[model samples]
Target: MRSVNNHCDLYDFSIWGNEDVSSGKGAKDENFPVGSLLISRKLRPHVQAYYNFARVIDDIADSEMLSSEEKVKRLNGMQAVLCDDVPAPDRADVQAARYLRNSLLETGVSFDTATDLLIAFRQDAVKNRYETFAELLEYCRYSANPVGHYLLDLHKENADIRPAADALCTSLQILNHLQDCRADLIRLDRCYIPLDMLRAENVDVQAVKDEGTISGLRNVFDYILDYIDDLNREAEQLIRLTSNRRLRMESSVILTLACSLTEHLRKEDPLATRVKLNYKDAIKAVLYACPHILR
Candidate 1:
């Protein structure tokens, strides 16, 4: 019942510090690879650090136990720690910010790439419904695009490649939204699907709670998938624009996975069951990455 407008003490990290609220999910728990073998071993630590930081903030936003006000307060505390405005508490989540702060200092990557994610997490703490696809993309710009920016900076890849990187990251974000649409709606009462599209198709937001996909909902899914197709097409340039061989291979593999997942979403009903990449998809991603190995 806490009000977000109230002047909550940002330093009161102790309220939720009694217990960890992290989903306990890690890089491997993600749908895509993270700091995998394709990345240079020397830089892997930085990638892991960034991932840990992102994971912590994302968990704060998604926690059901914390009120929206508490979530925002904790997130602000973490951001303050990341920017060196305050000392990190003993809490694991707050400590994650300190770890990434050190990593950024070591690597010389801009802190903006990391701070931008907080913008999306803050939005997640309060905002649930996306009114349009453009709005969702704006969310992804902060939530997903910063991930690409971090990797590109980490690898010293050209800034020009960001367009393609953004395409891939945004595609992946939408894919996840599609895959988790039902769970997101049922558990959090959040819907990432564009409300306008749902209305255009005559589908209500609650339709996601059904055991199976309705015809109207299916139309909405296809509408989103078709946009993902365009994104994948643009994302193909990522593999080509990347100068580092390992990064190119990694981009190729992820691009393949994104396309494969898009196909899965297109053919499968996410509401009926989980639609995700399988072992066959993994094999395909590796095979696709092979050609880029010697590049």
Candidate 2:
């Protein structure tokens, strides 16, 4: 098993695209999400590449200022470009786009799966609000769950564990959106707080965008908090279905981070402050995953 894992790790490494890492932002941003993966020197490289791809797409969607139609067009074209089915266009930002293209070739990640990722981001660019929780889950299925599913495919084990991982990843993503509600709303014009919940709270959609200081803001937060709690509980049940030590530790680390975020949110006003973890707490999470390194 060790030999097989080592070989897989090598293949994974070859697939990792060399990019500018001087900012150290990637490590810092994933402080909560992929702590367990970082703890192990043996985690697959392609897994890291996949993360980079997601990061690039998400950052482009969230941080950049492209027109909505242009953003969707570039994202929709990504699959063909990555697969060498299309030539590099002048409009695409070559550096980031090249990294994705090369990483796709090195990892043999299929165009279909890669397209799913792009489509998710494209949806993010234009689709600001979800109509229902079920609609949100479908969004999660596209945006968040694919990362976990793709990683499982790379490992060639834990196919059975994916349903649970799917749930957990979706929960984590939703948790992030909730935690960053004010930030996302103010900066990105995106709101994950469902429209139905807004109606229940009597918060006008324009009010959320303009003032964000309505009775409905607090009520919406409370309602979403309840949903996040329920998802975490379901995730806890799913984590028990996996026996793989690395996977368990990884899941535990994510759960702990989610729990920490959830707990912190519960104690403080998320609208008033951004919750952040210090390096010490991060080190502790990494250390907590140490015992499972061998698996």
Candidate 3:
């Protein structure tokens, strides 16, 4: 609730704040996989701070070493920090919270977007599998939609863009879930693929662990691809609606990659192998997307 700029310093902290991520992975560079050059340099860090907040909380929620009770306590501590309800445990949490306070005072980033993300993270602490596709999507509204809303707020775009942006963000989340389905289950006991869909295809969770394949789940891959296509198509409206040239191009690049990956998923079994977009395709996506993006 309280603004952090004058009271707290963001520069003095990193996301880890002396705690090891063990993976040695640093903060989530909101600009990295996407590229800093695509957007203004000045704006990158401000938004990346939000990403750092997400990464830190995600670590707390996703860390395999911690007991569920510990993760929940740490996560609730974050909510308290955000609410100015309690003192931050580290300089990074304080700094990240400060950045959000400033964003609300300056660029119109919503408190709900910042806070609701925790709800999803908390859900991760307990919930394992989604019973239906619609259920998974409802989760995406909490987990993914906040991100799109925040981005729009950052760029000062029209509020109407939120729906389309939500679609784009949700598509990315679902795609990543499919790509990492094997790791998620084996590592965290979490499964993002809806159970009903898998059942309809005649597959079960054990089939996933025994082998990467969808455990005799016929049409599973196609079903996922079809959903990806639908979500991507719906998100195209957002790409076209984006007002800023840089943001528009950036969204286009993402959409291009999303489509290409969907095509690849169609050809390969996601349950069996992790599909990566090669460097060539990555560069091509930028080039192809740049045309309309620059317009």
Rank by lDDT, highest first.
1, 3, 2
- Of the candidates shown, which would achieve the greatest TM-score relative to the real structure? 1
Tens digits of per-residue lDDT for model 3 on 136-190? 8988988888988887878889998888888888888887787778888899999
lDDT of 2 by residue, 133-223 (tens): 7888888888888776765554454567777777777877887776677778778778877888788877765555543345667777766
Worst 10 residues of 1 by lDDT: 1-10
Clash counts for the predictions, in order: 0, 0, 1
Ten residues in a row with the worst lDDT in model 3? 2-11
Which candidate comes out best when scored by lDDT?
1
TM-score, each model? 0.95, 0.77, 0.86
Residue 43 shift from truth in candidate 3, angstroms? 1.3
State the C-alpha lDDT per candidate. 0.88, 0.62, 0.72
Q: Give the better candidate number (1 or 2) by TM-score.
A: 1
Clashing pairs in 1: none
- For residues 1-295, write the lDDT of model 1, one tens digit per residue: 0122332455565745677679999876778999999999999999999999999999999998888888887887777778754654587877898899899988989898988999899999999999999999999999999999999999998898899999999999999999999999898888999999999988889999898999999999998899999999999999888999998998999999999999999889899998989999999999999988777
Off by over 4 Å in 3: 1-23, 26-35, 91-95
Candidate 2 Cα errors over 4 Å, as ranges:
1-25, 31-43, 89-112, 206-215, 278-295
